[model samples]
Target: MKKIIMAILLLPIFLNFSGCTKKTNEIPKTSTKIEKSAIEDKKSKVNIILFYPSKEGSSLSASSRLVSFNNSLERTILEEFLKGTDTKDTLYIIPKGTKLLSVSRKEDTIILDLSKEFNDISTENEAVLNNTIYSIVNSLTEIPGIKNVIIRVEGKVPKINNISFENPFKRNRSIFNRDKTSKPNDILKKQMEFESQGRWLDAYLLYSDDENNTYRKYFDDYVKENEEAFAQGFISKNFTVGSYTVDNTGTHALVKVKFNDTNRELNIGMIKIEESWMVDWIPPQ
Candidate 1:
């Protein structure tokens, strides 16, 4: 009878050990699922458009920035646009004390009611007036369902200089920056544009073969090793193209860039390869 009781007590211990062993083997599978979920979450991102004054202060340019997916995407985009660019390379055209009163959607249009402070912008500078209007308009129109933007100040349609706010404002791509007969300058502009938006691969592809340039030979490896620094370096440096000189052959060019972060200027070298102008070397940070 004692042996029978002993067997009954040991049975529970044996079953418990087996169950623990099974779970131990399953742990790796559970961890893998969690890792995959994290990767999927990272892959899911949304793009938001932001308008900022050009580095050369010519006009406003639109930059695409990524953010985590959210239900209130419009509201989130508006908030981020209002906050302005972190790098300060571009000017925040919005007036101070401005608030987003309300956002209403109708069909394919979005109506934004802004606070009275928005009307306080000076109309003397027509460029400023135009930029201010479309900065808000252009930024909001980037949202999927918003084809047009209607703006109101304190619930009343206000006039910004000569332009009327009564009608819905469509996107004005012409107002954005454009190339002006300087193809090499345009290439440099694109390089900075991609870098600003954290599109490293797009930016890296602009480089050309230079045996002396480490960035060309080990470009991918260098970016992988210094991913964080590479991103920070590009985003933080607001480069203003100062002066550009092209060789008589049109194959070699030296472009000077002024940085907001440093007093020193950066001289970037470019070479025309075949029919395209490519960056010869990565600019020193």
Candidate 2:
């Protein structure tokens, strides 16, 4: 009878210990839900520019693309840009075989290391060439805080057929749609046409005083020295006007031109002296 009484007293104490152990081992359901909610909130949506050929096939036009934010935002945009678009009407700017090897960022600038297939772009189509470059530039610059882009191929700055890709490019919104009444555009078009038709003197007449004197002396020396390449360097098979930016004061401007024989843009600087807009002495500024 005494042993039975001791066993009954120990049973309540054993039940209390088992209940405490179960409570301590359980996880809070609220904490797990909070962690999962934080992970879902990290993802966001951003708008990026995608360039495609216009309806007439003459130039490239910008279109809006919605993308999910990722750690490598610029790379994600480029990969999507390379993939073209879902709609059948849009087109890819970079060549089909081209590959983006790597991308790195430093403050306001993004550096792109691309493969050799990028070098083989057909310059005969000037619009395609300019679009290929700006499609990358304008698209990447859309990301907040990124202002410029530098491109390299095969670990070296590209220099091909009188074109140099060594300069860093700024975002050009002017290329989206050209302004027909732009005086800078008219002057550049006339000058380029004159040169393409072998009218060197007519083309030189459109230059500012400094450019005229410099080119005159250059050609005179070239003629006397029997150096043909120096003079021939000014000539191009054809050119298409891409973009132009005029200062607020309306006296200075920068015009972008792409040549049929070269893959890079030629930025021509212009100044409005008195009444006429003339190509300045310094071509690229």
Candidate 3:
């Protein structure tokens, strides 16, 4: 009888140990599943660049965000663009109620279908129309393996004035205002060379005569003042152009130059005059 009672007591202890082992193993399995799920969620996200119209409607500005990677990435990008940027200086270029209907991809191009509201932008000015079209094109083309974009409105190609959506549109970098046509670095270099050589007349002629220019007076007075300043060592002869950036309008630029001898840096203002870049103002040291 005593042996039977000892056997029953050992069986209860064994059962309790077995239950504890099972619970310990279950905890790691559950934790492992949770970690794997978090990793997959993290891997699904990617960063994408988006373009929008500046507040002035004169140029395109770029913004970036993270999105889920999937077959519908193109549609997702378009949807994010329609939602617009949160930046106060940029505006959504698409019509308010426009919707992305579908997204398909060919060899190197992404084809987009949009709602009828996209076609309702006929009353917008040319700049607005251009911004709307290129904002979509540029944003999509930024994706890898995408070279062009074709936009269709309600299953039909759209044509507003001379602009047409029947053909694939490539990214237009000129709309970013950083293209070769708007760069003012070369003009600033030439003006610096002229000033260094004491050719005041040539340098003065590089100034814009636009009515908005408040820096220049008469041609004779400009030349005389520059000559006197050079004789008095007011202008440095040894300088190097560093870097420059053009304004959003593409009509104005600020160029940074370093005086090699004196180790001083100054910003020179430039303006576009007719077809040429001209020096509008120089900061007084």
Best by lDDT: 3
Reference-based TM-score, model 1: 0.48
Candidate 1 lDDT (Cα, whole model)?
A: 0.63
lDDT of 2 by residue, 1-285 (tens): 111222233457657778689787676776677776765663454444566665344555656555665568788778778777665654565567778899999987999998998777665656656666777887777565677799899889976544557789887655554333449878878866665565444454465533123332222221222223224343454567777999999888888876555455666788775557776755253
Alpha carbon lDDT of residue 39, candidate 2?
A: 54
Tell me the deviation in Å of residue 50 in model 3.
Answer: 0.5
Please provide TM-scores, in order, for all candidate models, with all chains considered together: 0.48, 0.46, 0.51
Worst 10 residues of 1 by lDDT: 1-10
Q: What's the ranking of the predictions by lDDT, best on top?
A: 3, 1, 2
The per-model lDDT (C-alpha) reads 0.63, 0.62, 0.68
Write out the backbone clash pairs for model 3: none
Model 3 TM-score is 0.51
Greater-lDDT candidate between 1 and 2: 1
69 in model 3: Cα distance from truth in Å?
2.8
Which digits, one per residue and each the tens of the lDDT, describe model 3 over residues 1-285? 111212332457557678688666564544677788887887676555578888777888777666676566677788778887887787765668988888999977898899998776763557866886798888786554577798889899886678877788987766764423535778778776787687654565465545434444543345445655567565665678768888899888888877666576667788776656877754422
Question: RMSD of each candidate?
Answer: 18.6, 28.3, 25.4
Clashes of each: 0, 0, 0
